[model samples]
Target: MKKNKDIEVRIEETKKTISGSTYDVTELYIGKKKIGEVLAYGPKEFQSFMDNEELGASKSLDLAIESIIRQWNLHE
Candidate 1:
């Protein structure tokens, strides 16, 4: 995929407590400078699979970008 100059993507491991068990999840960040509600790689897609699975940083970024592009197309 081509690089996007307007948006920045970052992913990191996050720990959350669920049923008293610590779970690690891959968190995807896009356009940190523009903060607000986002749909890319959001809970709707991420939580569809099993929880606590390791999603590579690049994979997360790619997925987020793809989602954003698809959403952008819908508005066009």
Candidate 2:
């Protein structure tokens, strides 16, 4: 699970409210930039997205990071 050192990963727990119901959302960030979000409860736990583009989903964060690296073509 090697990643570029310059690329930072952060997961934040957030609360979203809709129709008087509140739910938790996990947001993915690279450095200070936001990449995408995933629901805490879902079939695809590590789904990634950016600017409305789906970066595919994986069962682990390592796989998700790999997808992001390929998508952005970041140097490892």
Candidate 3:
């Protein structure tokens, strides 16, 4: 089994043209496969992730990564 660090997630914050506002994701990854992730974000920005579509999709990747890691452990 791989430790949490073995997993990875990537995220890109959405930018607002009007107010120059932006938000970051707490976690992000490819479809059903996590390579790495950022676990922390600014207060208001972190909340935005909960309502962001990108974040939702990334969550699936995270799940897949976890599953893969668990399966690897069983083999070990």
Candidate 4:
């Protein structure tokens, strides 16, 4: 399995708000490919979405990355 360091993340600052809040949605990427998106409210608060599915919220970005990799069956 690939670790967080192995994945390249690119955050796109969107002007759209989430849940009626001002939180921005950031897109996750590995190299030139987008893997998922995250609605990050804080450092320990975020909601991850991938493959047109909501992967839910979590406290750690590492956890979110791991889940994305696992759910997508990505290999190093």
Candidate 5:
């Protein structure tokens, strides 16, 4: 996918503990700012982590509106 100048995407892997349990972690960053994170058990963990509310919470109402604007501009 083509990268957008206004928004940057970054992904990193780390370790985290939840409820006294340790697991692998995957984090998403937008322009050097962390937006959300995900946790899982194995190779498919990254996919599983994305279903978390934290990822959804990253899409605020304002952000959604801004994204729509950007999309409209690109199409035009």
Candidate 6:
């Protein structure tokens, strides 16, 4: 776990395939602990995630970060 101040967003290659295609995965980490990942790399892929996940936040990035922090109990 981390203070969230050390939160990092990183991109890496993966052999995993999604929807019959493969993309460089983006991962979120708090210090050394990985919290989440996104299989989408482009705008279309991101939109796919939003649609499939049914995320309705107007500010998706902010909401995603906040959600992760909240789940990690790092909002304190």
TM-score for all models, in order of appearance = 0.37, 0.49, 0.25, 0.59, 0.46, 0.40
lDDT of 4 at 49: 82
Whole-model lDDT per candidate: 0.41, 0.65, 0.36, 0.71, 0.49, 0.46
lDDT of 1 by residue, 1-76 (tens): 9784564546556666667775555444454521111222443443312123332222353454455444444543
Candidate 2 residue-wise lDDT at 60: 71
Q: What are the per-residue Cα lDDT tens digits for candidate 2 across 4-69?
A: 556567878887775787666667777787766654334447666655687777787556656765
Candidate 3 local lDDT, 1-76, one digit each (tens): 8566443335543333324644332334444643333222333222212212223222343453354334434543
Whichever of 1 and 3 has more TM-score, that candidate is 1
- How well does model 1 score by local distance difference test? 0.41
| Model 5 deviation from the true structure expressed as Cα RMSD, one decimal place | 9.8
State the displacement of the C-alpha of residue 35, model 1, in Å, after optimal TM-score superposition: 9.1
User: Where does the lowest 10-residue lDDT sum fall in candidate 5?
Assistant: 49-58
lDDT measured at residue 40 in model 4 versus the true structure, 0 to 100: 71
Of the two candidates 4 and 5, the one with more favorable TM-score, higher being better, is 4
**Candidate 5 on 1-76: residue-level lDDT in tens?**
9876665556677888878998866666656755556555554323222224332222333343344334335544
Candidate 1: which pairs clash? Answer: none
Q: Give the root-mean-square deviation of each candidate in angstroms.
A: 9.4, 5.2, 9.6, 4.7, 9.8, 6.3
Give the least accurate 10-residue stretch of model 4, judged by summed lDDT.
4-13
Q: Which candidate leads the pack in TM-score?
A: 4
lDDT at 24, model 2: 60
* Better candidate number, 3 or 4, judged by TM-score: 4
User: What C-alpha lDDT does candidate 6 achieve relative to the native structure?
Assistant: 0.46
Name the runs in model 5 displaced over 4 angstroms. 1-6, 43-76
Best by lDDT: 4
